[model samples]
Target: MTGHVRPYRSYVYAYPHKTAYRPLPEPGPALRDLWRDERKDALSLYLHIPFCEVRCGFCNLFTRIGAPDELTGRYLDALDRQATAVRDALGDTAPVRFANAAFGGGTPTFLEAAELERLCDIAEKRMGADLRAIPLSVEASPATATADRLAVLAERGTTRLSLGVQSFVDEEARAAVRPQRRADVDAALARIRDARIPVLNIDLIYGIDGQTPASWRTSLDAALAWQPEELYLYPLYVRPLTGLARRTAVTDRDWDEQRLSLYRQGRDHLLAHGYEQVSMRMFRRPGAPAQGPDDHACQTDGMIGLGCGARSYTSTLHYSFDYAVDMGHIRAIIDAYTGTEDFTRAVHGRYVDGDEARRRHLLQSLLQARGMPLADYRDRFGAEPYDDFPAELAAFAARGWLDDDAPDGLLRLSPEGLAHSDALGPELFSAEVRAAMAAYAVK
Candidate 1:
């Protein structure tokens, strides 16, 4: 409506993309000092595993292709050291609490069963985050979702297991540069069900070359055959430095139109099948086993992240080790992370001022299908969204994207607005953040 009509610009799962972060001055704020005044009653803990069996074409996540046995060992050791440092920073007097935990990465299941056990120990024993008592979620790949690795996760009380099966069609998978067979994916899904994780989330992609509406329905029906508790429909974006970026040249109009069509088709198909939309990308069965509090939010809550790829969020700051997507740079960052000893202070991060925090809160809350409660925003910032974003809301209204029929005090997006979430998300980005992201040279 405001110019760019393409639905997908960026997937803003987190506010302020990591690229916006810069080097902190020597010896940045101590973790304890950073958390001193922040709320800790309900925090999120995340551990990142930067190893994957193979690099997919459409992937730009912070991970490497493989980790030798020794590399995995050292990586865990470094994780252990980081856990100790982080726990020390949290201090024992007040009893820090974790509401949920997740093991994510290139593929968390890449670790052996024993190593997985150790990873859990590092979280529970060292950091005092009880995986068994909390909702633990882990990501796996078709090749890495072995019985042994899955057993470790289930035994440690993983509430959800998200399998990255981008497509059920083998050729489509290959076209996406993710070489895999449909049979293997089916086998992996079977194993996940066998593990009996409370919630199973299968991720699929649309907009791949040659993916038709029929083929899209085929994949969706296949996923439904398993009665997956959750499914994420991601539009394939050939991010810079990714495998697909090298071989693919997409015209924005045609590609965007194709993606939008597939998205609507997929959305309608799922809705007809009784799955409720959670977001443009997420859909879930009505009674899926709940993973966490319905109110769990990342915008205001604090998070503790371990590993080079993970970013820890405090109320005022988000920090992590340097980020990279290039294989060479990724390997170098991982090596530095593995060899590090004293992981005491934040070295790289950005300070979140009042305006940035407000923007983050709005973007995060508004992106959900549930919309955002004006009361919540007003209570937090003492200002309404309309007061802060009149022009933006007016533009969305002009395009009929902002939902006017939402109940009083609730701000929501119309169906088309949800479709353009990717575009709208970046539209809210502060000029400073956009500038920073634009200036960041991908290493």
Candidate 2:
């Protein structure tokens, strides 16, 4: 435990923070120019809902605990406005086609059944995205994943429903400050199964204070009972501004070793249960219904995001409304988002240069279990990944993390490397991006 290495840095999910984004001085025209020559064959649509029933202790996402009365309605109205503005900006030149759609955030299902219907309508009617033609995914929480709400989502062509169930043991959940009963979780699973959605993804967390290997196994078994289409095992990080941050420090190496061991245990358990390891944290049941559109992927395609916390991406810029973790800041951003009339230009984002784009391609590919196809990298960037990222690739190989000699010219992670994905992802961040992210004010 004393010498164990853990992932202590930032979670490198998306590149850059809203802090890196500056106001577009020209607004509408600037956005039009940015999207002028961008590829529009396969674009992803993301709609964010920033409200939650309760903020989990280990959570540090851009979402508020609860919305005041009428806030949800107003938020939808604002989303409609933004969608209209964005569509008009794309105009006739950008023949954008929706390849996939997802509703994410604190919890999209937190809205009432009727509101959820309206949410879908905005994406379909206002944004011109055919939700029924493409794969649609939505996130849900046990307390908010009501039957009526699930029905609304299912009716709107939701192919996959992901539910977050951190732990099956009530004590472990309480230790994580999640505050859920096993019975409620079980009931939620039952309801999700009854929803008859094409796919179900169950999310679990490891490394909670009181969670042991045995308890982790118990939760895994409980989740497996439903035979979910996908399972995402997340390692809990107590980040600043989160409820658990005040109670725990991020510099605990002993906890790192505990998490490493638990991760291995859980990974092995899921593998033995006939689940295929998709990455360090994701497992898919073979033959499960597909989750997203096959044509579009985050690695190359553009995305249009609506709602306060949602981040949209073009080839050059990734933009979003102001990002914040503290409740006060989140509420302020949401309020401002709901009040804004102009949505043509980016408000906050970091620019992606050629180098940054290369790095993004590598990070998006290398961190997965399927690994990066060397041929594909060369084809996209016109340069070999090893040549561009020589030092990083060599260091990873020396650390026994990457296998450079895989067949078909593929670069993939070893089993040990997969376990250290959290560390590897942050290590790939460029110095400039790292500095920008580090300088961001969490609140």
Candidate 3:
């Protein structure tokens, strides 16, 4: 008899909130001190642009809707001041040698051309000329992007753009509360291509309410017509406190199956069209490396996040500031920055404490389809996976969830493993590691 597949549920268990974790110790090591010790393989920078024309129903990122020009100006000033503070804190530390710099958003295009240039200028001054060769990636909503904006980005060294093109079907877009039109995406793509930026990524979402297999196919076809250099496909995740969570319920089993099937179909389609899976959910033109794959900066090393609601990680601790546009939080960050008190202490309480270096090494490696290198693991942590996680590694291998080999030894997740990656964290990691991760989940 064939096994019965369960229907897909729209709701998923929410990860733990960051507040539950303990705060870091006071007078901890300075930013420069930390960077000096980080593995110099590669470093990257993330600049958060927290302004948005409108917030999507499924988005839980830090942003404010209908932000006026004056507010953006104030935020830019704050960003500049913060960058200076970081520079001052680094004093005599080694300069940053970044492999890539990303401007993630709310919507990066929401910023005026001047504001974007100013931010890039700040980065260039601090990170130096080395960053010019690095891929500068920025995300934009198609409706908000313009030729002038694309030109400005290209002039400032932005080489790639990730366009949020969630769905081609108007009804599906409405259901997801994304107010972009198909025509806007087409025009924006043309403008971007014309700017001579070598890479363009289109982001598509599946499993949204009102989306059917046919609608998904149409979305894929529409995206293919543009021949974007890259594609990122993600399933709808109904995050808590989002508009969609309150207004709708996701309980369609067949719809869930259709969603996964569509992802597989999309992957195959892209591959046949000459795109390769550089990583899960990411596909790029054949022989063209996905932006920053060789550096492995995002997952391998902890990044310094400088913005409201951004999270930062170091070798020993994790810190995050809640720039949620919540008046209280904003006031707290401001007060902290102005020396009303230690704002870092007040706004960004410590979320996790442990061997963050080892944790990052393991998690990032496992997340990548190719897995982690055994030698790198031993070199960093002073022990092999088998020696450190003997029982867990053995059990995982027994279940065919991970491969056990040196240099090429990777903790790859089989289909069954991929289905349970979240759960496997607790099972594979040590109790200390699990506790550190759990601490970050506290509200």
Of the candidates shown, which would achieve the greatest TM-score relative to the real structure? 1
Q: Compose the digit string of candidate 2's lDDT tens values, residues 359-388.
A: 888877887788888888899999998899
Q: Give each model's whole-structure lDDT.
A: 0.90, 0.83, 0.64
RMSD of each: 1.4, 2.2, 4.4
Off by over 4 Å in 2: 1-5, 17-29, 293-300
Residue-wise C-alpha lDDT for candidate 3, range 397-425, written one tens digit per residue:
66655644424554566544433343345
Order by lDDT, highest first: 1, 2, 3
TM-score of each: 0.98, 0.96, 0.83
Provide the global lDDT of candidate 2 against the true structure: 0.83
Tens-digit per-residue lDDT, 46-137, candidate 1: 99999999999999999999886589999999999999999898876676899999999989999999999999999999988888899998
Worst 10 residues of 1 by lDDT: 292-301
Q: Residue 212 of model 3: what lDDT?
A: 70
